[model samples]
Target chain A: MSQPAIETHDLTKRYGKARGITDINLTVNRGEIFGFIGPNGAGKSTTIRTLLGLISKTSGSATVLGYDITNERKEMLAHVGYLPSEVFYYDGMRAKDLLKYAASFYDGDFTQRIQDLAARLDLDLSKRIDDMSLGNKKKVGIIQGLLHSPDLIILDEPTSGLDPLAQRTFFDLIREENERGATVLFSSHILSEVQNICDRVAIIRDGRIIETQSIAELRRTAVKRVSVTAAGEVPLNLATLGLPAGSFAGAETEGPQTSFVFNGDCNVLLSALAARRLADVNITEPSLEEIFMHYYQDGADRGGAAHDSAAQDGAQR
Target chain B: MNVYLFEFRRQWRSFLAGTLTQAIVAAVFLGGMYPMYHDSQKDVEKVLAGFPPRFAAAFGITKDMFSFGGFFAFIYVYLAIVAAIFGALWGLKVFGREKLDRCMDFLISKPASRMGLFWQKALVVLTGIVVMNGVFLGVALWVRTSVGATSPGVGQFVLMALAVGGVQLIFAALGALIAVLAPRLHSVTGLGVGLGILGFVLSALPPMTNESNFKAISPFSYFNVSQMQTQGTYETGYLVTAGALCVVALAVACVAYVRSDVKA
Candidate 1:
């Protein structure tokens, strides 16, 4: 129980010049709901697939429940329950039959468990899978994944086809399982979904983990989205401002306005903008996307130069 | 074993369909026409002689066409192609069904090893072929005895019927190989049908193509019904080829499936 739920050291996968996860180092402690947040094509699925042995890794190592993924795959899988993003099953099979087939792999009888799950999810076990709606099929997938009560539960975009009510029920189920001593790795592109449930999150962008922190710490990150509309020509790039290298994120210039996600001393930015004949300046809290850009730039700037600025404003997102 | 039973449950209907097709074809074509053709051999020969030599040869006609052995061989030639088609698609369907259904990730993440999955699923294909051709052999024998096919002994007729099993086995292994190796293989049925017809065309073309090892690659060419009628066993050369092909195909499929990634 003291062992981490998952541990990966410099885990990397390369798809022959295509974008795959690179130098991913991560650890999920036992009995924790660890969020894996990223935008689309950010390698969340690839990382999960690699850990599950759906895809092979080019280099590095990973283990789940203290079992080596590649060598002890079968033993490792025995303790893992996975729900793929898209739910699909043999269409001709009744939902009950598919769940029974899934349960046969585990040691204990899941008959009562399946019934309880089916009742909780409002799923009809007797319906043929083809005749079921997409949401119903998803419920079947959920039951199949959870019937064994595996030690580790890995969900990749688990709520896409579910209704809002079902989503709420699903989240409640996950939290219930977490309380019952199960560890979860919840992968999603939706930030709020992760923020609401996860104790800690690892943010991935362009196949690299850019930031990993507690939910509160992530919210408290000193990143701001600043858009400036000046009467004069907008600065061609953020580099011409002569601000500290690590203090600001990359900028986007649209016509007479230049917008950038900024981090660190707000007064430095205000004083820089004060020198220009400013028509308007809007400094608002950054979106999760904007915060990602801030971290993305921080990764680049930290690689080339020393960065020590840690000033944060009192703005709430 | 659980996987095999689950697959058998899902696939028995399709297997029965294949068996039923062969039974109907055998009952209608052989049971209906054998006595008439037997009574008026010369008249039918005269009509068949009017056909061009290549066309007659392509359909496996020879001087012994009046005999029960030759008559059965003529019908069997086309039936073998049907069995091959069934074998190929059944093989592909066993592996490709999950991918086509988008349930590969869920099924693959189960605790079973890929090799375990491969063997169990492959057992289903072998079982289907045996069931299909087993019923087929029984029908053929029943028709032959009812029509009183006199020349080819029971041993020879049984050997000839069992040759369909050989053809099915080779094509089934080939189909599984394609499924395990090719991730994006669309239209598995189309490819199966195309390859089945190609085998028949290749076997029928030696008289025109000057017999340049073209038949070597075709499962249809791997057995001679006339030879089976006379010798009571498959040819040693083609028998070796079929065994080698089936072994190599199934072995490669097992290894590749076990090692390769299950693409989503």
Candidate 2:
């Protein structure tokens, strides 16, 4: 097999009394759109920074495109395209000047590549960087970061500022790059986009990698979003049924309706609720958003992990 | 190489402004005051002699005060201070402007190493200093010719200019060092200007107090103006220390910058 695009072994970065990443072991294989999903302050940026050599890791090691990040940054960055969450270029420069300046750092002439990307992203190359709105500047950054046609593209919230239509074009561009054999490690807050395009994904929370699995496997988990409406005297013990913390969605004891994400046996839940005078019931597969919430809010317990192995087998059918 | 060229393209306006400011200071000072002082040389000396020694010392004039060289020496200290301040701010901004712009990741993520980037930025500062001094020297020479008195030899005049440039270099190098040491700086003006004025105070203190030892504290005193006036050259020890300080500070800055984090 070809070498993975990125590999980190127990990579850790500890800020002084701040929550930096800890023991982050990740492997993004070549030619895959790998998603890095985490909430704000969840160490996603820290991990990406450590890999990019923007900050020194407190311990452990990481390699990008087979070159050690710490020791071989120059050699490795030659082939790596990075789009930071914020796009702030030098002041008083035009979009084309910024792109040309970025191109000057590489080996080949990227004039045609830059023109192609600016057209594709619908960016005005002659506009001054200071005059462009946030979205336009982000488009400039996208073109600047991608014109080199790198072997691996690392984007941190690359679609944050773009409008819906621009985001569509941006995603299409990324897909084209991926099809050209560029591995992509995309970190973003939008789970639906991750669900729509990512082949495999990793979920990070509280500075740790909570879970890593394929998008299909993650969506295929046995956890069900179940809601029920029952008459008086209806009952259920949520604590004993292994419903995740904050997963009950206000499944109040006195309310007429109760809803929760259930990861336990469906038959057991059904048999227990059979005695109730139920008026309405709904059980459906949870979206990736719901599962991502479970992984983030459920802590280190078996909230999501309990169904991980089961989900892989469930996908077979 | 591209980084260096880009820095020049980005900062040529600022550098031109700095150079113009120095030229204007020289023009106004020499153009407005030099001829009046030249005609009333004896009268001015008598007035200066009648003044309290402490007040005279405050102006950093020790022995000679009549000739064009002495006149040139009179303005060198203040010019050097201004140059030093400009260099300090230039160094800080050149090295850390990306941080202030919140765009460190944009350049630091390139294929170049951090040290390579540091040297390129440092070269920009050095180039600016050369251009600033070059323009200042030309302006001072033009002012001297207009005064129609050329007592100070060409070499001595050049030494005085070099001394000011050297002082500016020290401050610029030190400023670059401070920038690399800081993770990020919001406004470098406070630190740059504060330290610059402090250096001026320290250099002035020794001459004001009649203590040669105070000269050890500031690079401004490193190029003894009297030595440049008399011998047409710099003192070997202080000059070597000044040069060494730049080398060491720049070396340390490169090492620190290569390891320091670029904060957003």
Candidate 3:
């Protein structure tokens, strides 16, 4: 079997005892669009920087395209293209000059590729980088990253400064690269974009991977919004419902309607509801945000710790 | 190689123009005053002879101030001060270019290693200094010949210019060291100018204190203008010390850069 395009085994990085990332074990299959989803300050950039060998890992090991991130960093980088969250270049350089310089470091000439990407993205090659707007700068970044036709592309909040139209064009270019057999690792705090493109996602929180699974599996099995209207005043307290804390939340009481989100097995939730005399009940899959929130607030809330660990099991299932 | 060439091309026109213009102007103005000073040489010498030795040394005024070569050497000390500032500013800009511009991510993410990046930047700084010195040498020789101060031989002129160049290198290395050690480097040019002034002040102290050890610590004292005019050589001990300081500063800068976190 071929090696995975990207893999990490117990990878950890710390900033003088402060959390950077911890015990991260992950795998990105060849030719798949993998998502690394997390909010700001959640170690997403740390992991990406470590993978690129821009920063050293404190412990554990990782590789890109079968080359070790430490000893073989330059070789690994030869095949990887990265776009950081904030795009900045030498201020005096024109867009064309900067792109040409970027392309010179790699193996092949990228003149035609630069022209094609620049024309498609509506970037003016003649404009100085310092004089361009933020959106235009981002467009230049996209062109430089794709100009070399790297085998692996890594983007950190790639669409942050782009307008709606520019973002759409950027996504189309990414899709084209995917079709050309380039594996992508797309990172973003925004769930919608990941949902739109990723084959699988790894949700991170507090410097740890809390869950990893396909979007389909996450929606179908792990979390569901449930509403139960008992025949009489139902058990309003979650502890009395015989379900674990975080397994259910947002329980509200209204006239003949009591509802909460259920985040565990559908069978257990249905059986629990069967014990109560009910006028009606409904079970539905929740959105990705709700599922992500379950992991984000894992230990912060006194009642959600159980659900965070249970969500890990759901990911495995 | 591409990065070095790009930086070199970007800086060449403005840097060479500004430095060459300043050197030419200084050479012309200073060279023009020599004929006037020589015409009244005996009167000026009698008046200067009455001042205390310490006061004369403080102003870089020597007993041989009546000679053309002596006057030129005195003016060269002031030129060294300006060259020191120029070198420091160039060093800070080239060494801290990525951090100052907030482009560390763009540069470091490329295929080059950090060590390779450091050497490339150092080459640019060194090249800028060399070009500036080259222009200064041409202007100095032309001004001396045009103004009829042909007493100093070609070898002596070369040695004096080389000593000034040595002082510039020392300050440039100091600037690189400071750029690496400071986290923010908020105003690199300001820091460079401040340090250059400080080094000049320290160099001026030995005359007042009557201590040769004070001369050992400051690069300004490394090449004595009076000694260069008379003996036609820089002090061997100070030259070695300057070379040692340059090596140590550059080495520490490389180590600091390789270990630093490329913060966004």
Best by TM-score: 3
What lDDT would each prediction earn against the true structure? Answer: 0.83, 0.83, 0.81
Q: For each candidate, give the interface RMSD after superposing the true interface residues on Cα.
A: 1.0, 0.7, 1.1
| DockQ, each predicted model | 0.56, 0.78, 0.70
**Can you write out model 2's per-residue Cα lDDT over A67-137, one digit (the tens) per residue?**
99999999999999999998888878889898999999999999999999989988889999999988999
Candidate 2 positional error at A101, Å: 1.1
TM-score of each: 0.87, 0.89, 0.92
- Report the Cα lDDT for residue A235, model 3: 42
* Model 1 alpha-carbon drift over 4 Å, by segment: A220-262, A265-290, A297-317
Q: lDDT per residue, candidate 3, B1-264, as tens digits?
A: 977987788668746864775586557655676777778888888888898888777667776666777877666657777778877887787888777888888877888888888888889888888888888878778877877776778778777777777888898888888887777767876887787788778877888678889998878888876677788877888878989999999999999877677886
Candidate 1 lDDT for residue A133? 89
Tell how far residue A196 is off in model 3, in angstroms: 1.7
Error of 2 at B55 (Å): 0.9
RMSD of each: 5.4, 4.0, 2.8
DockQ of 1: 0.56
